[model samples]
Target: MRVRLSPAALLTIFGNCVKIKSVNSIFDFFSWLAMAILLITAIPQIVLNYKRGSTEGASWLTFGMLFFGMTVLAIRSWFVTTDIIILLNYNLGAVIVLIANMQFVYYRIKK
Candidate 1:
């Protein structure tokens, strides 16, 4: 006796073999790693400025570049995936960089 496979049955079998949630979880971890990196990258500058009572050593140029890159990441995120992982990752980083940028500008003008 020979068994015939229908398209739907084949698809069901293939889908069962491919765990989409696992793939998504991997991407989630990747996004979290990126968020952690973004979180730390500006902390040293923020702390140094706070300790020194000035933003003298920090560069607006660096923040500007970071802002530009994060902006692109945020925009690209709008059209991708479930619109949460990458969006949150990039937008939060953008906000952090924006705050750092404004602080730098304010201190630059103050000093």
Candidate 2:
């Protein structure tokens, strides 16, 4: 059976619609879209690493830089505003980077 995804479902999962005050509705939608895309940018590489049971194709340096960058952005977002979408973007990016980093460690140790 094929499952259908509604726009509401996508917004519910990726967009903090309720929490975000509407400044311009179009801009707000695009902002959430951009944020969601940025947040998941690392997922493909992470999944690839996991499936391969190795991080050979991934770079520790890149993940380290991403973790550092995301941490800084999350910290800045925490201090600057309480916008849920912004907060989620940076914070979730950090978590994703950390998970990738952990995979690096795990696979390295296993070798």
Candidate 3:
């Protein structure tokens, strides 16, 4: 006996095999990892400022600019994914950075 496969069926089978292998998707994992690094870098600065009770050498203007830019990026990232992990990570990072900047401004002004 002989078997015949339609073009559409063959394509679907190939796609399924690719998916099963987990090697055919175009999603870039590194971009999110980079965003995570950006977030992590903010932590020590925040901790230091908190511990010292001052933002003496820190530039509020720099943080303000970054906060604004990241806010825009976070908004743009929203429509790009249904993945809760990505959305939450970027948004939370933005919020934390914004709050840290505000604290810096407050401490600078208070001193």
lDDT (Cα, tens digit) per residue for candidate 3, span 40-70: 8777788888899988777788788878877
Better of 1 and 2 by lDDT: 2
Question: 33-77 in candidate 2: lDDT tens per residue?
Answer: 855775567788888998999999788998899889878988998
Residue 45 CA error for candidate 1 (Å)? 2.1
Indicate the residue-level lDDT of 38 in model 2.
56
Query: 1-111, model 1: which lDDT tens digit per residue?
Result: 999999999999889767787798897898788778878878777778878878876777888999898888777787775667567788888888887887887777888
The alpha-carbon root-mean-square deviation between model 3 and the true structure, to one decimal in Å, is 5.5
lDDT of 3: 0.78
Quickly count the clashes in candidate 3.
0
Range of the 10 consecutive residues with the lowest summed lDDT in candidate 2? 16-25
Candidate 2 to native Cα RMSD, angstroms:
14.6
Could you give me the TM-score of model 3 versus the true structure? 0.64
Provide the TM-score for each candidate, comma-separated: 0.65, 0.64, 0.64
Residue pairs whose backbone atoms clash in candidate 3: none
